[model samples]
Target: MDTEMTSEGVAFAKQMLADDHAAEAMGIRLVRAGIGSATLAMAVTASMVNGHRMTHGGFVFALADTAFAVACNSYGRTTVASGGAITYLESTALGDELIAEAVERTRRGRSGVYDVTVRRGDDVVAEFRGNSREVRPRA
Candidate 1:
């Protein structure tokens, strides 16, 4: 959270993270957040490595997806991923610090698009595109 974020953004992020048990269990931390953007960080641990000794693609995707969720929901609306895809560009190993930065691309009515880039230091490891749909509360 940053000082520039709106009160709605802060509250939304806080509530979302609080209920995100998977992200918490995976050691994900919110780095910053704004109206239509968010950044999160996760560290690759032994359990995240695959048989080939590289970080599993699922873990990388999860990090990107979490960032996308936060970015899309920064408006204080409950936004969930309708669909998402990821392209793995590089391999990562244990002890690597992965940073996922998400940006909103467009929003039309209840549908929104977000892109998240997962990087290890200066190198990009994965790119994720997510489609979000805001869920309206029941009256």
Candidate 2:
């Protein structure tokens, strides 16, 4: 396991997400994490279900998005998602467990990139590329 999402790491993410009301309303849980890698899981409730009773894409995105947030800020500083996107590779049912794995790509100056994989068991559900803004020290 990585150090990014250790006991302390989980606490960090919990606080961040708690600050984001929408994320909190979405029921995003910080399942596991390390220094550069992180894993998250969210249950598919009625609010997160699609017409076919499958998990909605937005719900999956939320999980990955939060994982990206945790992984990027795990270093004890804030990082904001500048821009990015995700591609859905498969469909997951209401009871399916979605997993997100995120790792840093690079950080130059004040920006960074993170790659996140969203999966259900062995099947990939979606993939995200996140661009983040590094938080500068307070003046």
Candidate 3:
């Protein structure tokens, strides 16, 4: 949690922020990034709402997944999610600023596990767990 990121980690995070068009399009912003952890945030917009007027689950999931991706790749090796799962605890309304915090749970060789907690203020919104594998450098 307090571990400082190495030079490689900083470079990797910068590359990711520059390349992540999907997250940028969703208005996701990098709140913090460090070794094996990352925090991201996005505001729920009217277009992100579902039929119930709550923010869509997919958007919440995407935010969590993005955080996971950032954390897992903080080591600087190209990594990709092997799988992930999420549970929704509460709904979010328009203008709600949602935050997702991801931390490394366990890592073995090329594989890693990350836990992401999504929150709207102090209210828990969702929980996500992602499994990742370090792949080769991107071409």
Candidate 4:
């Protein structure tokens, strides 16, 4: 695990999370972050449960997506997800503590690829892949 993170990257991630009302509302906490990696944790709440009594897939995807966003943007560049997909492998219920860990797979020029795994304890719940594009600053 290459955990070499620049000081600016850490500062930027902290500031980004501060301004992210959606992440804040979901109780997502930043476990750790590096240059191209980040880990986040969220508890499955009652509101996140679906009609089937399992945690909603959307909520799981959101958690993974947020982790992916933080990881891609940790390079001190303005990166946005061009596309993302998730595969849910297990079901979770309310009160489950879910952790999403993201790592950069590759980066070239203005594009990057990242993988995130959502887990409940030692059980893998979902896997997510995200494609990212760095936004150029307007001159």
lDDT per residue for candidate 1 within 18-101, as digits (tens), equals 789999999998888888888999999999999999999999999999999989988888889999999999999999999999
Error of 3 at 115 (Å): 0.1
Ranking by lDDT: 1, 3, 4, 2
What TM-score, computed on C-alpha atoms, does each candidate reach? Answer: 0.94, 0.83, 0.94, 0.93
Per-residue C-alpha lDDT of model 2 across residues 1-139, encoded as one tens digit per residue: 3334365655665577668877678766666666656777777778789888878888888888888998887766677899989999898886777778888899887788999999888988899999988777467
Predicted candidate 4 versus true structure: per-residue lDDT over 1-139, tens digit per residue: 3334567976686677767899988999888888888999999999999999999999999999999989998877788899999999999999999999999999999999999999999999999999999998457
Give model 3's clash tally.
Answer: 0
Q: Assess each prediction's global lDDT (C-alpha) against the native.
A: 0.91, 0.79, 0.91, 0.90
lDDT of 2 at 3: 31
Write down the RMSD of all candidates, one decimal each: 1.7, 3.1, 2.3, 2.7
RMSD of model 1 against the true structure:
1.7
TM-score of 4: 0.93
Pairs in steric clash, model 2: 3-35, 4-34, 4-35, 5-33, 5-34
Which structure is stronger by TM-score: 2 or 4?
Answer: 4
